[model samples]
Target chain A: MTPHLSITDQPVDVASALAAVQTDAAGAVNAFIGTVRNQSGGRPVRRLHYESYDSMALTQLGHVVAQAYEKWPMLQEVAVVHRKGTLELGDVAVVVAVATPHRAESFAACQFIIDTLKQVVTIWKREEYEDGTEWVAAHP
Target chain B: MSLKVALFGITRDIVGTSVIELPAPAPATVGELLAEMRKQYPALGELRSCAVAVNNEYATHDHPLRTTDEIALIPPVAGG
Candidate 1:
């Protein structure tokens, strides 16, 4: 099955993401969903603004998926979606799901996708507070 | 030959533009290009970390750049 990897400006479709990784041969599926929170660095966050380098972001996401396939050869299907633009508190920021013959590999692949994506994907987030705004993790 | 560098996130905020053009006779390599960028835009040096990508792939400092290559500044990523 073709992996569902995308960066979109629209709201993330969790159901579609899960469906993308569904296969008859799969015994277990694992998913990781990331959402915006209300606070950061002890300050109240009004919202979050996400931006992407577009082409390069997609390329990096593809690389992450490719690495996942190499690490988990038993993986049946995978789906990863990240949202861009302003996001309200409690809104989903990203979703990653994986399907495999066993539960262990499903969980491992899903976790690996999200973790590696956070480190490599060319996407950024800026936290907006009632007082001001600052980019998340833009500095050490 | 001039080179156009794409910027995003905080780098765009600091540079005040989405794209910056280097003067004629661009730097020979990625390392030289980074040094030239820091000199031209001092605020870029303050970032905790910054990476370079050439043609959509992460590039090392020694990666030689061609005139037709696509270049971008990648600030510390926070995506989940």
Candidate 2:
């Protein structure tokens, strides 16, 4: 099954990611959603601004999903959706869903996809506090 | 030769531009390109980690660069 990967400036649709990975033959489906929180590093964050290198981010997402497929060959479907733009607190930032023949495979693949995507994807986020804004993890 | 380097995140903020054109006779490799960029824009040198991507793929310092290659400065990523 082909993996569904996307980068958008709008709110991430969690249902669409889940639906994309729905397959009758799969017995287990797992999903991981990342959201913007109210605080960071002891500072109260008002919002977040995400940006991406568009094409490169998608390409890296593809590579991450491919690695998961290679590790879990039984994976029947996969979907990764990441949002880039100004997002308020509690907004969905990213979603990773995977369907496999067993629960173990689904869970493992889902975790791997999100973790790898964080490290490799060409995307960045800036934290907006009451006083100032700083790019998250940009320096170290 | 002219080379264009795309910037994103902090690099964009530091350079104050989305894309920048390298001077004529561009650097020959990723390492040289980064060095040249840091010299031109000293603020870029302060980043704890910076990566170079060539044609949408992470490239090593020794990787040769061409004028037509899609070069980008990738700062530390924080994507979820």
Candidate 3:
């Protein structure tokens, strides 16, 4: 089967992705979703804005999937989605899902995807507060 | 000659865009070029860790730069 990896700016539908990637041969599906929060440190955030170099970000996401496939030859499918634009508290910003014939491969691949995405992809987030504003580093 | 550079994250936001081409001095080190860039773009100096990359590969401060090559100052990688 084809590798079902994707990086999207639209609101990701977990249901749809789960259906599309489910296979009889694959027994486990691991997933992760990053959500917008209402606060950062001591500041109370009113809203959050996310932006990215969309085409380049997707290309980097694809590279992460390729690396996962290489490391876990049993991996069946993968998908990584990221939201771009204004987001509020509790809104999902990123979703990474992986499926494999066993639980360990799916778990490891999903973690790898999120870690790689955070490390390499070109995405930015701006936090807005009532008193001020700031841009949070997507990583350390 | 023109030396193109890739800007990311806060650098892109403060500059209001990315992928800029600026004039380069003749045969300068990456450190020298960055000093010139910081002068032209004062906002970049505010960043704590602006990494230097030559031709898409990361390099140290003293790496020599060529007029015909691409140079980019990338802020720290923050994605997760």
Candidate 4:
């Protein structure tokens, strides 16, 4: 089976991520893509620099996937990919995909994975504007 | 014992190093280590929040620390 969680500096490939969770038994698939927006909190974003405590981030991601599986037993598989390092506006920052036997479960599990990952994963991003930069927390 | 703690994100920038070694009290728990870190690096206290990880798992402040444990300071996460 492919890894259920990953943290990398390379661009997140949505297709490959979807393929990882796809299975013959799966009747539904859902995905969530997080992109670097042009603006945040009314500030114009020039770019974003992401960083991670890679080992810990991967461990936390596994916990998130495990929780999703426990909550939705019908889920066939889940894949979470997060990009680290600098990214320009509009670049994909992260992707979470889930495969299940039904659409509702797939969507719910996908959302749960991303939400929990954001809360527990050890990743951080520095948002840079034209004037300055600041490290943003997952929660306000 | 001297314990080396890995730093990330803003913590790395504030301490100006990726790793820092602290002379921990004997039989130190994560709480004790955090106190020492705060005393040494006041900037860490200014963050909205932070978490401690021992051996790649999220650790409670009461989690015991050994000389061999891999500890890291995890500032607030922002990943999607």
Show pairs that collide, candidate 2. Answer: none
Query: What's the fnat for candidate 3, on a 0 to 1 scale?
Result: 0.36
Off by over 4 Å in 2: none
Which 10 consecutive residues of model 2 chain B have the lowest summed lDDT?
Answer: B40-49
Sorted into a CAPRI-style docking class, model 3 comes out as acceptable
lDDT of candidate 2 over A18-113, digit per residue (tens) = 999999999999999999999997899999999999999999999998899899889999999999999999999999999999999998999999
- Tens-place lDDT per residue, model 1, A17-57, is 99999999999989999999999878999999999988998
> Per-prediction count of colliding residue pairs?
1, 0, 3, 0
> Which pairs clash in the backbone of model 4?
none
Top model by lDDT, which number? Answer: 2
Error of 2 at A92 (Å): 0.4
RMSD of each: 0.8, 0.8, 3.4, 1.6
- lDDT by residue for model 3 (A10-78), tens: 776877777767888899988888888778897889987776765566666777788888999999878
Candidate 1 vs candidate 4: the TM-score winner is 1
Q: Compose the digit string of candidate 1's lDDT tens values, residues B1-80.
A: 88889999999999899999887889988899889988988888888888899999999999998879999999999997
Instruction: List candidate 4 segments past 4 Å from native.
Output: A1-3, A138-140, B24-27
Give the docking tier of candidate 2. Answer: high
lDDT of 3 by residue, B15-79 (tens): 67688776644437778767877887887787766767675555788898777766666675555
Backbone clashes in model 3, listed as residue pairs = A118-B79, A118-B80, A139-B78
